[model samples]
Target: MPAITAENPLALPRVAASPDRAAARPVLAVTTAPSGLEGEGFPVRRAFAGITYDYLDPFIMMDQMGEVDYEAGEPKGTPWHPHRGFETVTYIIDGTFVHQDSHGGGGIITDGDTQWMTAGSGLLHIESPPEELVMSGGLFHGLQLWVNLPARDKMIVPKYQDIRGGTVKLLASQDGGGLLRLIAGDLGGHAGPGATHTPITMIHASVSPGAEVTLPWRADFNALAYGLAGSGSAGAERRPFRMGQSVVFGDGESLTIRADAAQDSRSANFEVVLLGGLPIREPMAHYGPFVMNSHAELAQAFDDFQAGRLGTIPAGAA
Candidate 1:
């Protein structure tokens, strides 16, 4: 066996589904957009943002950090910043990310690892490539999702959950044709490692050629899936999807995904990240990194950050 780095090393176990499972949901719509640079010139594709927040409630934003190969000594990433009244989730797919916060919470999330931070009351943090990676040159790809907090829990205490790649539960398809990595919710009878304030499910799945899997989901939840790699069909719509496409689903209790084996012998597998949650439905006010229920609250957050009340990173702690 080869050595296991911080990347994926666990052999996902296959999970069989009972023959009497319910029908899968249907696709309601498909969304495609271009990614732009943000956070100090890092390229990113926004899956959901601004007015789309109302459509995908509880999810403030979903950014696909476009894959980029950084030459040695290249400078990139988000510097010190402030956040209030929300959560920031960083899922690393192919790089090392070093993070530090004012609350003294800090860690490194490598390939396949995840860092879920709750900037409830307030906090200052920075996310950038580790110095070694920057100096040596490497590839970086990942996703950053912002989850909105309900009005009642907007000011709760800040917290962090850094989950390593191997710790994430992986379930194989009943027919041994696919795999599902449960990151933040239950799937295939296996629960994710992180605890969430808002009820939500975040899963990453890859299906092999001609294999299919049906995943049960909450009927009341609003769900969306982004194609990470390859092409395949999803839900009852069975619509053809290519890379970089985001598919929204209609109300249903289950979701089905299949791989198009005819595409290519080596690239026949389909990969995606499925996310959803119970809509919060509350009015939201967002200003840069701060998310609140009212303009007054948003203003206060800015004031606090400027006054150094949100805390600060220790000297030379980057």
Candidate 2:
């Protein structure tokens, strides 16, 4: 769970919500993410599988890449593929990944680092472990989130952002019990480094055992809290949640979560990914890698991909 760290969290800037009159969000529901294999048999948890899309609007899907320790020479990654009509935000928490795209947007991201790629019109891309990491085979844990582009931005020019770990905006809980790493979007008046086609907020928090975190958030954005490494309770009522589970929050001005008194031995702190995004409220036609507004557009995407209009692998690649 080395998402990044500070020598002294209390020394960092502190952030606090409106604790006086702000209403804490209610826990709407909790869903466990099912385990599965993805991208050349790498382990994954479908973070939003059972949840309805209405609750995760403007966001398509998310995968929690292995928190598993792999034996030497056993690591794997996704082969070349095509995607359109969305952006993929990959945040590496404890390992390294190399990303490449046909649009000439790619880079290496390691622990606490991020790579944001927008497959605006379309593009071919590949994600894989570095050669050294593959040969050494160690722990690999990260997240990949698919954020949808509205109809107007779906066909715009593609781009990429390599956000270094040090660039992340770090904040301390008002009481200094939790460490908040803002990866993208806005929180209070502070902004993260990644620029998105849609309005969204992404955070990774490490809360000490028995500590609580309260965050001010945008009222219009839908909120979700996903457990990444340990047990915790979410919302005003304190609904329990653990690793691989997601908690949806009802409308409110602030979100709250508390670490369990005693956490699992695997991790020392309660690690959670907090996400909120403005709803696109548009109909979706999704098939495999393409997310379009209609079936006809999806068909056109497939046709274009088959006709080699999406993109091509660079010469002598890999």
Candidate 3:
């Protein structure tokens, strides 16, 4: 197996769906997003982050916040933690994430900024805490996703990609009403700036109410959408979906979205995170911050951390 690194990067390939796969019954799988409870003294609500092939393959867990107000000089984000054999993608919609790590990568994910970190072999990092999640009574909103690394590249060094909002490229919908930012790979003619080793595509889209956007898809991979705002209907059944909900598409040729203008009174536009990639059906064994195929690999990662075989440490903050 090739080791994970800049040269031998680990990523899953994307395959278009075959006609037979596309002809399968259209399943509008709707799994209620889980909410985070009191853990580690932090109260979080989990809306759409988890490990499930029916949703996002090779991707585990999704966390979100509506808005947060930080007190002057107070930490309002996650503290230093260790992770192995996976990647963390942070998309900031409101507030900022003062980030630092032990693998020579660090930065702040301000509003509309994205922080993509790869903890291949091992790395210790922290997302600085924000102050007030419930401001004078406002909500905090954003997303955090975990994507698994392939077995061959689980022990690679850690890296970071801090993508500013304006810097990410956007593509127009067919009707020119909605916009999409391709964060990982090419979507139509649009491509994001983040460096990726896998054949994956993470897209953020903004669609006006009553608008419809169709995305070409294939069966070799799984695709899903996170409803950021407003509400809509998707798939063949046209099931109703609202904010804080997610819709998954089975192996098919394309994804069609229909906006809900009735909900425009609450929100006129909707935000979505469309993520899909080829599935890696390998056995998965996971601990708090580590993921591997077996108990032995997980133990080895812990041993390496204790023995300091992973790599170098991060430098001063920005």
Candidate 4:
């Protein structure tokens, strides 16, 4: 099979939920994009971090990284860093990212690939564009999400899941008008590739103009949708949203997205990312890259990193 690329979109037929579970969910709130800022070394727009939202529960932060084109030899990407007590999900829509971590984990995530890293106790890592990409220059677009672990599992061993785009289960719209790629958790009888410490669902969906899709969602889980490209109405409220908006959903068993039929040809294909997870309602004591339940634990995390307790990537390994 050919590599999945943005120009050659993927499509999965949408499977309808049972009639009894098809109640329409409405938009609870629409979050505007925050000011773009330089993170580590690249331009990023934060969608929801603990600082901006009252409670995103299990989710701590979401960063939309470059959709910007770069000329050859341009500076790009994040250097080595430390993280603890959470999982980082990197979904690449375009470009390539080479990742190396203290746990001896390393790989390249290209278009349609996802790197789900569980920084259970702690881990040092680096994510940057491949040298070739940096040398030749190209477009880069992706999202990095930080997911909090429940208190009990916070100190578990770190792990990594590098999932290929083609391996993700795809669900098609009944009318053949859209596709949904399930990266984690289950959707429409399809199970995702990544196993999680917490229950969560990550879906990337693309809907052609005039397509309508309804997906069954766990009513108790906190759910939100990020408009990736084009424009569409979400839920029964028909709240109109364009690219770059984040829409939080109200409590209901089902969620929907309907692409605008009148969109210009260039913008007719609407793309979105839907995320939902059960809340880990414990206290969160966070310090920079570390997240723990108490100040003491947070302090220990830093001390450990300083003492080289978290493993290190060998020189030249990255």
Q: By descending TM-score, how would the candidates be arranged?
A: 2, 4, 1, 3
lDDT of 3 by residue, 1-318 (tens): 000112211121222324443453255576666655422333345655543654565777676654333344433456567789988888877665567777667777765788998888788777754444323333334678878888887877677888887777656566644566667766654567877655567887666677776666644667777777778777767777766677777767667666776655545566667777777677888888888889999898888877766644555542
Q: Give the TM-score of candidate 3.
A: 0.81
lDDT against the true structure, per candidate, is 0.80, 0.92, 0.66, 0.81
lDDT by residue (95-214, candidate 1, tens digit) is: 888998998899999888899999999999999888898898878888899999999888999999988888887776666676777889776567889788898999888776677777
Error of 4 at 237 (Å): 1.4
For all predicted structures, in order, the TM-scores are 0.90, 0.98, 0.81, 0.91
Best-to-worst order by lDDT is 2, 4, 1, 3
Clashes of 2: 0
In model 2, state the lDDT of residue 155: 90
Clashing pairs in 4: 12-171, 12-172, 12-179, 13-171, 13-172, 13-173, 14-172, 14-173
> Would you give me the overall lDDT of model 4?
0.81
* Tens-digit lDDT track of model 2 for 109-204: 999999998898999999999999889999999999999999999998888889999999998999999999999998878899989889999999
After superposition on all CA atoms, what RMSD does each candidate show versus the true structure? 3.2, 0.9, 8.0, 2.8
Scored by lDDT, model 1 comes in at: 0.80
- Name the lDDT value of residue 32 in candidate 1: 73
Candidate 2, clashing residue pairs? none
- lDDT, candidate 1, at 244: 72
Check candidate 1 and list the clashing pairs.
Answer: none
Model 2 misplaced regions, further than 4 Å = none
